[model samples]
Target: MKAEAERRGYQKKMEAEKEREKPKPLSEKILLQNDVIFACKDIARNSLNYPDSFEVENTNSGIDNQNGKQIYYFTLDYSGVNAFNVRGTHTIECYGTIGDLSHSVTHKIFN
Candidate 1:
């Protein structure tokens, strides 16, 4: 019985996911620090599982300081992302793939 219930739940989840992927007229503005702009319709889907991703290179000093990594990590609060309303702090406590690949900070975001 548990297995059957799980299957039904999985089906519903899949349908909901498909519904989300349906394209719609873009709306909503994402505000980020510095000169970079993050729009809701701009990012890509995370193939592993994350709905999307926002990468930043910390090259603040225009000219590379010879050995500086060239970019810095920032935070983004994207909790309010969805079909209805695209605005709110995200549930993201951190960023990156599975298994402690590497830890990094993030910049906040809005819908």
Candidate 2:
């Protein structure tokens, strides 16, 4: 019974450590600080020939760590006119880190 109690204590400690290591939910202010919106707008401008007529709607976002580096993921929905003046929506997935401004558009879907 003593050994079992010790094992359970160790397990509880391990569970608490795991919970502490998990990433917390990102806030809108942090997104702005990371320039996520600007990156989305830049992508829209490059993809579509519109003059700032596009609207950026953030569908989802998350934070993760890779190789000890904090990486940010964003999914944005853009609604605006295309190069041919056809109105449509675009879904863009972006991932990058802070400080270097190294954001990249991973995927884009036209609708």
Candidate 3:
């Protein structure tokens, strides 16, 4: 009976030690906010290389300035976010009637 009790105790101790040695998963929730700026200009006036009309449309991701010309500003409110999903560059997309264009911006949160 004493030998069986000692074996059970030793097994419990080993299980505890194993649990302590295991690495815990790394995860964290964070709040992300920033202003996304979209600069636009008339193609005819700005050397014929810019869009005639450009603006941001509201989507599931966030909100933006609805001015739709010259400059469009956006405020992001991504709260309770996961670290892994946001660990890279963020892309802000605005539609230009002439064609579709996208700008890639770096996120400082990773740094």
Candidate 4:
């Protein structure tokens, strides 16, 4: 009947609305690249109680630093990203400045 079809259409619209409200998660795996001049050790040595602004948050799996190994493990925070297509991958940025030197690094996280 016409009423049944209308009800079905209403239900479908509701389902579609729900789907639109819920965005598909970006990814589960994140890789962080060390774009600084020094390794973790050097960074730690230079920084002393400094404040870093990290734009993303995630769980860290581990660190990889070898040929073509440009990634670190981390969990993803969906609330961090406000825009899309910014970074081919999602990342958290940590920025710090000291005297004439400024350091910035990004960490990618997984789902």
Q: Highest lDDT: which candidate?
A: 2
* Model 3 regions more than 4 Å off: 29-111
Q: Rank the candidates by lDDT, best first.
A: 2, 4, 1, 3
By summed lDDT, the worst window of 10 consecutive residues in model 4 runs over 93-102
Any residue pairs clashing in model 2, and if so which? none
As a TM-score, model 3 comes out at: 0.28
Would you give me the overall lDDT of model 4?
0.38
Off by over 4 Å in 1: 26-111
lDDT of each: 0.35, 0.70, 0.33, 0.38
1 versus 3: better TM-score goes to: 3
Q: If candidate 1 were superposed on the true structure by all CA atoms, what would the RMSD be?
A: 18.6
- Write candidate 3's Cα lDDT for 1-111 as tens digits: 999999999999999999999988632211111122222212112222222322223222333334562322233211221334332222233322211133322222211
**Model 1, clash count?**
19
Clash totals in order: 19, 0, 0, 6
Write the residue-wise lDDT of candidate 1 on 1-111 in tens digits.
999999999999999999999987532211122222232213322311235433332222121222433332333333323555443333222222112223232333332
- Give each model a TM-score: 0.23, 0.49, 0.28, 0.32
Find the number of clashing residue pairs for candidate 3: 0
User: lDDT (0-100) at residue 39 of candidate 2?
Assistant: 74
